[model samples]
Target: MGVPTLVCAPHRLLRRIEAGYLDNPYHNAVHAADVLQTLHVIVHGARLHVHYLDPLGLLAAYLAANHHCAAAFELLTRHTELDVLEPLSTADKAALRKLVIELVLATDMKQHFSTLTHFNTVHQLASTKSFAAAGSSGEGLLKSAPGGRLANVQQEFKEALYADGGPDGAAFASGGPDAAAAAPAPLDDSERLLSLQVALKVADLGHLAEQMEVHKRWLAALEAEFFLQGDLERQMGLPISPLFDREKQGVSKSQVGFFEFVALPLANALSSAFPGAQPLMECLTSNYRHWRRAEREAAAAAAQQQASAAAATAAIN
Candidate 1:
């Protein structure tokens, strides 16, 4: 648990990171801060600190949240004053840099499904191992859990799902399809970087797990950014990306699709691995429901308007 001391005060480095981000509506400094805070919560709540990640890995995870892209890493490298890894051994420094880069890269939407798949594999394997070792018993399976309280909760979670033939229970019991794929590179006691990578990805999309009003605010900012991109594309005589054409895309439908395909699955995978983080899935579910309802209402209104137009045309004839 020997995290290195920073060359300068932590706030000094944080200020530089904050200043490096541009004024993009959804990708600015505030978004970085939100990801950092969310990552911190996920690590602690999931007990990653207790059982999986060492101090260096924990530091890397947090750093990846701020330096979430190659550009942000370049910003860090450009300034000697912000060398948080200045005090580490050469090997430790290399390891930390590699980890931070990989974690940041995983935040790319292109890698979204692949990253989620890997985490699911890890969780399934771990669940199978835990259950096997505990054989015909569920007690003390969560030794690394903070206290008896959470251990009990973990046990209850196990019993409710695995004992009741739940869908998740079947997946864990059978190790799913990724179990063989995960065997070659199983997790060790020292570092669970894969899990941390999943945590970073989830934190990047963390706004989806916020309260309804907060979630709407983030969606508004994101859509505004998308619309700006579409505007630039149109000006340059280029093709606009899907859902970025604000004039054609209905916000309700776009959000419903995004939540279903991207947000909810990722959040559910994380929560499945760490029951303590289940509240995240709950928030996401609520937000999803809101979007679905909005989608329905929008469709109904459109249909009504079309019908009214037809009636008026017939009257004119």
Candidate 2:
């Protein structure tokens, strides 16, 4: 509704939608549902009497959903939608699309610290304002939050996350920046803009806190695709991760890397971000840890059973 100065760009948008579906490992219909549900939780948390959330709950969530276009590329693990953003017109339609795209693009793992820092600052500012206007016991964030404290923490967090400097050195930023890089932009704007950006941020990370079965499926899909991509890299003699040691058969040690270096930390960090999210985060944490513990248990049990079978075979032999 906010895309003024333009009527519609169905052709371009449709192309984007199609590419989003094609490229994302988890950006399909299921991913859409997960993101929407994540928004619902955030919205409800803000609705709580203790944390009224400055009445920014629902709209913020929806804004995230609409901005899902940018992450569609990385999550999909493929170059499924880069071309379409070009056809989008200038004026307001392009402007709104660009806004949504920039925030969505910023959700990359490489930007997590920086984005969180920004979020913490703005969040603190919003929180402090809420406190002065209405006391803390009633809603949203910590009541004890101090004014301007948000900005400082945010900066610190950003430096901590991105301290190595530039995302180019990271595995996650391999795709590079998206179309939103054009003309650059600022964070200030209308409620429509803020709501959308906030929503996109949470939605971008929403899947980390979903049902185990759901998260498992995403893991499986991405891993399978990751291996395949790694294989292609080997065939072309490109610089794929060493784990891919693809010259040999079977999946590489990369899955362990995924489990240890990626999923585990992601689950831990997400839980700390939202107190209301503890339960779901635990479930996800358990699931992420399953491979480590469960595999051992299963192997031990299998070994005992195999011993019994060997005894029987030897007795007959």
Among all candidates shown, the one with the greatest TM-score: 1
lDDT of 2 by residue, 1-317 (tens): 22122233334434444454545444455565556565565434322212322222322223344445645434323533333333334453355445656656665667654554454455445446643554323112222223333233334333433233322111111212221122112234542344334444555555444454655566565556666678888789998864444355323223334544443333333323333433433443444344445556777999999999999999999
Cα shift from native, residue 20, model 2 (Å): 6.3
How accurate locally is residue 172 in candidate 2, as Cα lDDT from 0 to 100?
A: 18
Could you give candidate 1's per-residue lDDT for residues 150-233 as a string of tens digits? 334455544532332223111221222322221122367322677777778888888877766676788789888888899999
Candidate 1: Cα lDDT at 113: 74
Best by lDDT: 1
**Candidate 1 global lDDT:** 0.65
lDDT of each: 0.65, 0.43
